[model samples]
Target: MLQVRVSTFSAKQLVFSNIDNEFIQLAHPRLWMQRICKRVGLPILSPHALRHTFATLLFSKDVNIKFVSILLGHSSAAFTIDVYADVY
Candidate 1:
């Protein structure tokens, strides 16, 4: 099992912010990722790719499938297995 740190913050706080410390709009993170990838000479990846990678990594680590499904907001572990069977 993984242990996560617990912190207290306001419900309205932004998880990510712009350079000026203002709230970031929905598309800002993807645009920033594209710009950074171009600047660093790396292939641009979509947020969905990152999410898939995260799931693959977790599956590789032998975490419980049900737990991973919950984290990914899947309706059931069977769906997660069906989607990521290649990872296994």
Candidate 2:
């Protein structure tokens, strides 16, 4: 058997914890997203925008739509093509 060793650190030392203690609790995805948007000086956008952005970027990079659909957990490749064909 192969062995993998992991290092453990206190929550205080974690990068996510450095972002916000509130992240320690399960809150809205939008809350953290809004924080990031504001920090970057962009208009506040829903978390879904990130998914759409990923799909659009992958399309621009010429990654296959079927692969993108699977990564996005869509049930059908045609659905992915239908939804983002205009952007592509």
- In order, the Cα lDDT scores of the candidates are 0.81, 0.76
- Residue lDDT tens for model 1, 1-88: 8543323365444446644445767887788779988999999976678899999999889999999999898999999999998896
Cα-lDDT of candidate 1: 0.81
Q: Candidate 1 versus the native: TM-score?
A: 0.69
Find the candidate with the highest TM-score and give its number.
1
lDDT of 2 by residue, 1-88 (tens): 8443322454345323324332454456778989989999999997789889989999999998889999888899998988987996
Error of 1 at 35 (Å): 1.0
Clashes of each: 0, 0
Provide the clash count, candidate 1. 0
Model 2, position 55: C-alpha lDDT score: 95
Every model: Cα RMSD to truth: 7.6, 8.5
| Cα error, candidate 2, residue 12 (Å) | 25
